[model samples]
Target: MKRVASTLHQGALLGLLCIPVAQAATGDAGSDAGTQASPTLKAVTVTATRREESLQKVPVAVTVLDGETLERDNRNNVSSIVQEIPTLNYRPSASNKDSSLFVRGIGTISTSPGVEPSVATVVDGVVYARPGQSTLDLLDVDRIEVLRGPQGTLFGKNASAGVLNIVTRDIPEQTHGYVDYAHYGGGDENRLRFGIGGRLSDTLKGSLTTSVGRYDGNVENVTNGHEVNGYERKGVRGKLEFQPRDDLKLTLIGDYSDGENDTPSVVVKPSAAVAAGISPVVPGNSNRKISSDYKTYVDDRNQGLSLQADWSLANDFTLTSITAWRGWNNSQYQDNDNLAALPVTAVHDKGTVDYDQLSQEVRLTSPKGQFVEYVLGTYLFHGKSDETYRRLSVTNSVGNTGVADYSATNDSYAVFGESTFNFRSDLRGIFGLRYTLDQIEYDHRRVSTSAVEVNSIRPSYASSGSHTDSGISGRVGLQYDLSDNLTSYITYSRGYKGPAYNVYFNMQATDVQPLDPETSNTWEVGLKSSAWSNRLTANLALFHSKYENYQANFYDVVGTSVVTRLINAGSVTSQGVELDYALQATRQLKLSGSLAYTQARIDQFACPSGAAASCDINGKPLPFTPDWKSFVRADYDIPLDNGLDVELGTDYSWQSKVQYSLDQNPNSEEGAYGIWNASVGLADYSKGWRVALVGKNLADKAYAPVLSTGTSTTRIVPRDDRRYFGVQLHKDF
Candidate 1:
């Protein structure tokens, strides 16, 4: 075995080089140690953990996608981001404007406005509660980190599955700014993203960035008597930083997004409709006439404001606090079918949410002679969320006839403590515990107006619920440093998620109880190493998790007016292996790839199991669980005379077919498919300006990014298989 330096040390050495010439000329001790620097690998990331650690040295399994890579790939939407991360998948629903996200094998399939997501997305420290906001385009983001596995102890709330943290670029103390513009040949895809930032004073800085994208619909609306197609979107984000002193810092951020999606609808198949006991859509009717025009066009808007502060109490301790408020509104139509046979359903949603969360934490480390390093924190969260869903039944494309309203309010407080002991030089033990008390008040009201009924029925109910759950979660790991660069460790932790309010379209009986929170236990072991003259870095980890009483949506055999309800299933177990490797073949050549093999299934699940002899799911793979998925990306830049450079790169992903529906429909599985993307560009690396030609779906592979199983009509978006060539220009001032 060869001695390898830790990934953190390697990054620190690289940062010290500064263009490789100064250190080379000085013959510094750091420069004499190893591998030559590479120009293609200039981006740096620090989202591996709460700490500011280098991407390569982070102990956890993470994927880094910088803004430059996002631009070069011409990936301006959420769909494009998922293509590079094979372990992620999503499904579209009427409840969510965009598709609901799923990582590994856990995610919500029901787009019901009431169902909460299992995964958590954190922007700068503020947790985005709604699924619609998760897909918002990247905005002045410094880096995006996708942390795999349960992160409840650190991220809190719905992070039982994982966490997607978007870290925006901080305001630099120097004057700098950038503007970008791009144009696509197909669908007239046009985009503009620009931002400016500068130091107003030695202790004050601010930045503002805005992005807008629009395009004409590629599909024509033959029945609407006009071209019913394409989409338009606009987004803006701004931030300001105040640092009155070197030891304290306060930051404020605000963001807004509004967009319209004109994506066409996929027709429902006859078999699926018959299975759901719904009549097929009549032929010769436009999608709008059959399912309503709203489904064809999605109108979405969101706004967020947050504040973060950090105070360095002492050299061995620090204090931090975060507060935020967020709101989301979405109005969309779902064309249940391409034909007009069935009635069209139009839905309008109005939601307002305000959260006031205050967290106080003090981290103290061992001083010169101390042996105990500890962390203590107290958190208080107050939230009031009111959501109203208006569902209208349109006949001959008429107005709304009925409306459904759902709302909830929640208050939570917790106190937690953790401490690490240096039992030995080669072994460290971590122990932590947290106690939480949460109160929730739920109100559900539904009103219907029809010619058959002279006066509409107003059914309303309210409930006051409180639950106190106390649990202990901790990690025990042993790290044996064989050398300065090589280390290995094993850890185990148990985490729990608190139950949340479930909003139902129809009123529920007072006797019925809401779903309980989920509990999970995870065991993992991993190794990190860097070798081969410091040009190659490899990381591997294996983990197994077991969850009890998982919440799932199912139809009630005895219910009326409502189609689905939430219930807890017995148990589920998941296990997987992950591997990542990055190698610098040469100073200008680089290669990086990641592989994940996962097995997620219902260990003992018992659904309604409708009375069908052939329908048996005793031991079957869970829905939407892709067994094998991998990503490979490589790029090389060739420097030429003068200040010009040419860079070429490509990446590919292969996903195995997985079940898409809980009904176990054989046709619901999406078959294995591979997508290839390539890009070429010329730029001056020394200066901050560049031009690039990017192409997505170079092979024009037609595939459904998300297969919609809403109701009887199962429509699949025949993803645009046409090649889209685009040019991008960027300048920094």
Candidate 2:
């Protein structure tokens, strides 16, 4: 309690100190602005509803961030962006191929190839089928929109929770380029990014972007006398746009990314019995250091190509086609025991997944002056993936190995339509619907062998199966314009996720089974207001969702080994309230904040048979769902006499206690924590140059991002980059 109080006090003091400086600067500059008008907040446009519209007029609960804001705040990746959004959470897996993301208490916990993410990740207009692809580096991005609700009707399948839409920068007709460099304090961490765009001919334009980044590990391996968890990545992207006529356009995009890093290190927090038998804990070991007997590593490669075409037809009709091919290959090795003792247990996983997708969409949009505006669209998608997995567990006396080859294909078709009826000048009724059909087929084969262990040997197994399902999802809403500055809406929506298969390969192949599909129904009420002459914007949303046939990952102790399997739980419920506000206090000062309260629980669930332990988990909080989250940010600009400006900014975020596993054991809980970050910079926009110094986790707080429960011990992955400072420089031409 005392610590929390102290941190809050510090944050308040910082805010107080910065506000007066901004006020004084504004007062002094008023003398020269006699004829100038006060600044107002600019209108933000988003495509969250599948059409370009003003954010303030949209009826959905959404958050939008432009490229300028992201660059100014030094948010370089998806994980960092989650901190600013109150309703989102991100956790890195043991390997880069299986990160976890949760929105509104609904997400995917399993990293198997067969399982799909609940929150759809859409780049441009194409959805990434695998979560690993969503973790790619952000480069040349124009804007990002986070929609916090079921988006099944417009986004198609696998959108039960929400949607993350990313729009990349397009090729410009004029020639332009920029370069950026950043260097971090401690252990020589650095990054570089460059981009160029120009027109090759009257009808042809192209743009190219590339980035290279490297960071030293923050964790030290005491046993091996080496650093662990370091990372290096390289990426390149190219885009070409061709315009044969005024109403027809075509775009081609290709990208390649390669990254290698040390596997995430685990710090053991054993039970009382296990702790008593081991040596005394080292002083100052904390979560930043580990003692491991074996080495850990990961290597990943990804590449993709996409072609998009759009054509305008008569009477406001449009046709669109997208074709894409993406592939991922990864190899990972980890020291599972997380100890320096002999007879250690280690694991190696190597797999490759190749995906090809083709989609076509056609929409007929009614004119704006009509009493009823409507849009009708049809979509078709087909994708196929081939995956090969090899896992090895080695000990002093025996080596256990398992190899699996799997292939899957999916075909989805949907017809969707939405319309808005203007009953009055200030009232509107919105309705939408989508009918979808999905067909999936899979084939799997696995073989296991063990040396020096007669009982561990198992026969080779092969299986093939197919399934088909269909469903209807839709949305209904009513929006009222209360005034020029305030708008309110109420909505109800339904969403769905397709069925999946268990892809884990092991000696006990008999335990695997196909999992059922999941569905969700959500109701939301929201209010959006712009006050103080459009200088302040505030939004509030209250939502409730019920899920049926919830898919979950279960861990069971089979004989002497632990196995993971997918199952369909009975039901789950989630309710939450979210608030977001932004204020332009003055021409040179800006403030923004968000707060969310979520209560997500499993209404009914029963443990499956043939497991080491069996019990009911009724009325338990879902995994990775925090009770409360809040964030606040302040930015102030100080004008200088020489056409230069100094910018000062600070932000603070807090999250309540969270459960890392479904079991809800006391050891799996993480206590509440807060983080603070600050930055100072000097910029001259006319000259296209800027320099900034940024600091993160100024209080040097220690926390764990993930916790794993083993057979007898619990391991935690600590959040890296503690109390670090960095300098960033940017140049443009």
Q: Of the candidates shown, which would achieve the greatest TM-score relative to the real structure?
A: 2
Candidate 1 Cα RMSD after full superposition onto the native fold (Å): 7.1
Model 1: per-residue Cα lDDT over 1-733, one tens digit each = 1124234434533432232333334544243345445322343557444556565544466776676677667666555577677566666543344366777777655443334567778888777766677766778876678877766545544366777787888887788888898988766878898889989887889999999988764445444434344568899998989999987889988899988775555443444433333223342111221233333556777788877787877654657677777777666664433333434323333333322233333223233224555555665655555555554444445544445565665655666655556676645555556666656666666666653321112233344444444444444555454444444566676756566545654444621355577777878776665554455566666788888877655544321121444556557777887666676777677888766767877776655332221235545666667877778889887989997889898888777777775545664667777888788888885798889988877887656554433344343443244567888888888
Candidate 1 structure lDDT: 0.61
Global CA lDDT computed for model 2: 0.75
Question: Model 2 over residues 365-465: C-alpha lDDT tens digits?
Answer: 66665678877777777777777777666555456777777887878888887888999978999999988888877787877774232222234568877
Residue 391 miss distance in model 1 (angstroms): 2.7
The runs of at least 3 residues in candidate 2 whose Cα sits more than 4 Å from the true structure, single-residue gaps closed, are: 1-36, 271-285, 340-348, 450-460, 507-513, 612-614, 712-721
Error of 2 at 255 (Å): 1.4
List ranges where model 1 is wrong by over 4 Å.
1-47, 77-79, 94-98, 111-115, 156-158, 225-230, 263-265, 271-295, 341-375, 394-400, 417-426, 450-474, 555-563, 608-615, 710-713, 716-721
